[model samples]
Target: MREVAIVAFGQSDHVRDSAQTSEVEMLMPVLHDVLRRTGLRTRDIGFTCSGSSDYLAGRAFSFTMALDGVGAWPPISESHVETDGAWALYEAWVKLLTGEADTALVYAYGKSSPGDLREVLTRQLDPYYLAPLWPDSVALAALQAQALIDAGRTDEAELAAIADRDRTAAAAHPHAQRRGPRPAGEYVVAPLRTGDCPPIGDGAAAVILAAGDTARRLAAAQGRRPAWIRGLDHRIEAHSLGVRDLTDSPSTRLAAERAGVFRRPVDTAELHAPFTSQEVVLRDALALDDTVRINPSGGAQAANPVMATGLIRLGEAADRIQRGDSDRALAHATSGPCLQQNLVAVLEGEA
Candidate 1:
């Protein structure tokens, strides 16, 4: 397979609401920023892929409207996913590997402010059973949190600590919506405090991917290190919430293994665990020990942009490697309710 690396990443300052902005408006600056970091223009990109949920926009083919910011006037190879931006990155990775593209631009965004964000997420549930129940994101997460508590995996205090650590770590990330530790607020749902849940926010993120020699060249031009894609894979659990184990994530474990997460020690990990309690399940599943620095960018718990949160995880991990802060890093993204789908990507700096 052709080697690929994330040479640049950029994101907007996440906020509770971007009421005045359109999707194109929110995306333009981020797209400009990522391209500026790499000194590349839209026409220079060989392949372009984006991720966004039509449900979030409350319209069909919403991604196409967002493409106006991409400057597709000249025409180019492009695609999109109706999920998280990290999945778009996955597609771009495949394109590079196939030698169909030497460089790719991947981006994703979410404008969750316009609707009942919690209720909007419930759209992903089973249309037959779960959808009818209308278990909003936090409620479903609370159930998982309760199960973990019952299984003796973790309790409220530990979940609180996870929230504190992730948000505190974000103090240095200017783009993070929630920076610095805050009190674990009152429960939004039983066993899940307000702090335990991710902030409903709107934001956008973008990344530039280049293959092999092209990857090295892009980084060199920017005077940065390339966060090489050492391995990458994604796996999904059973769709039925009843049959799946809420206290564990077998799919994440399998994806991590397939992505070569265990080939060697990873110095840093950026997980897309939107809820604090989910972090417990993920930590156990990915086998991330105490030694691994997790969520230095505050994770989804700190700055969840819905469709863009997962991509930010990969970007945060890659940024560490690019800055020589980490020799090896792990990036993970999850979609669907209660982490139903998981994608794992391992990154490493050059020799």
Candidate 2:
């Protein structure tokens, strides 16, 4: 396989809400930052892929407005996904692998505050059986938490510890939505509490990927180190909640192996675990231990803008490599209920 590396990455400040700004307005500055960092303009990109949902904006073709942020007056080759920005990166990787494009731009954004975010998320479930019940995301996650406790895999204190560690790490992230000292306390829903939940927030992010000679050229021109993608893979598990084991994330385990997560001891990991309990499941499935620094960017517990959360994981993991923070890292993203769909990527500085 041809090597593909992330040459540049940029993200906007994650806010509780962008009162006066539209998604396009929020994206424009970050897009400009990406170009500035890479020493490349819109014209230099060979392919563009974006991840955002129409439901986020409560309107169809919401991504069209975001195109304005890219300055598409002359038009550019582009595609989009209804999934997280990580999926867009997956699409971009495929484009590069096909020899169709050497350089690609991937981005995602969401303003979940405009509507009932939890209620909206239920739409992601099975329309026939799951959707009719209208179970909110946290309630489903609570079920997972309860199952873990029942199975003796973990307890409430462990969930609190996960929350404490992630939010404590967020102290270093200027873009994090929630960061402060907290006493790990009682459960908001029997064994899960406010601290165990990620705050609802609005955010956007963009990343630039280049492969082979083009990647080298871009790195040289920008005087920036590149985070090479050592391996990337994703997997999906059975959707029926009752049919699958909630305590284990089989998809994540498979995806991690396929992504070569164990090839070289990972120094750090950025996991997209929105709820505190989900982090436990992911950590166990990925076999990450104390040696692996988890969520240095504070992770989803800090700022989770739905579709944008996964891409943020990739960007943050790359940032550590670009900044010379670590030699090897893993970036993981999860979607659907009880971690139904998952992606894992092993990254390192170009050797």
Candidate 3:
């Protein structure tokens, strides 16, 4: 098997609204930034992949338009996923593993401002059972929170603390949308307050992947350490909410084990837990103790860009490893309700 690593990572300044900027426009700058970081150009990329949602962009095949920024005019080896960018990154990693590409570019973006994000996300539910009912994302998350509380796993006050701590930690994160300490505010749902939820935002993020010698060369040229991916895996739970336990995430635990999370202690973890209560569930699933630093970049609670949020978690973890802030790290991304789908990757700097 070929070794792969993240050589570069960059993201746009996440904002509550980016209505003025088109998706292509928002992506162009980020693409330029990441390529410049590694001294590479669009033409140098071996493969390119992206992630986005048509529902959020209010159009079919919206990801095609975003490709304009990459200048695919000459044609490029590319693909896309209609979900979060983290999944797209997963695809690119596999591409590298096959030795089909020496360098791969992966990016994801989302603009949740124009539509009713809550209702739009409901489209992901089962059409026969849940789609028609139209339960908003927050309400669905609230149901999970209440379950955790009833199970004596966590309570409202602890959820509030998670919210406050994460957003506050984002104070120094340049691309973060929500920062500083704020009131937990009123309950949007019975067990969840305003701060307990992630801010609706528009944002983009990009990462560069290289395999084996190519990975080392890219990082060496930039005088930076490479964040090597030791293991990666994803798992999904039953789609029917009634069939699974909301207070626990067996899928997460399974993915973590497959990704080598339990093999050794990771000093840092970037979790894509959009809701405070979900963070509690992930903490237990990943078996993280207080010794581990969780979400130093604020995770999704600080700036949740939906499609791009998961990718950002991986990028933040890799960046920390590259910067010598951590020796090994755990990065997790999720899709669907109540952590139904989970992806985990264990990254480490050369020891």
Instruction: Give each prediction's root-mean-square deviation over alpha carbons.
Output: 0.8, 1.3, 0.7
Which residue pairs clash within candidate 3? Answer: none
| RMSD of model 1 against the true structure | 0.8
RMSD of 3: 0.7
Point out where model 2 deviates above 4 Å: none
Against the hidden true structure, what lDDT does model 3 obtain?
Answer: 0.93
Candidate 1 per-residue lDDT over residues 1-351, each given as its tens digit: 788999999999999999999999999999999898888999999999999998887998888989998898767799999999999999999999999999999999999988898899888888998888889999999999999999999999999999999988888889888889899999899999999988889999999999999899899988899999999999999989999999999999999999999989899999999999998999999999999999988898778899999999999899889999999999999999889999999999998
lDDT of 3 by residue, 1-351 (tens): 899999899999999999899999998999999899898989999999999999997898888899999989878999999999999999999999998999999999999998999999999999999999999899999999999999999988899899888988998889889988789899998778998889999999999999988888888888888999999999999879999998899999999999999999999999999999999999999999999999999999779998999999999999998888999999999998888899999999987
lDDT of 2 by residue, 1-351 (tens): 888988888888888888789998998898988888788889889899999998878899989989987767788989999989999999999899888998999999988889888889999999999999998888889899999999998998788888888888988788888885477655656667888878887889999999988887877777767889998999999979989889999999999999998777899999999898998899999999899999998999889988999999999999889878977989998888878899999999866
The candidate, 2 or 3, that scores higher on TM-score is 3
CA lDDT, candidate 1, residue 342: 98
Lowest summed lDDT across 10 adjacent residues in model 2 is found at 180-189
- Cα lDDT, all candidates: 0.93, 0.88, 0.93
Cα distance off (Å), candidate 1, residue 139? 0.7
> How does candidate 1 score on lDDT?
0.93
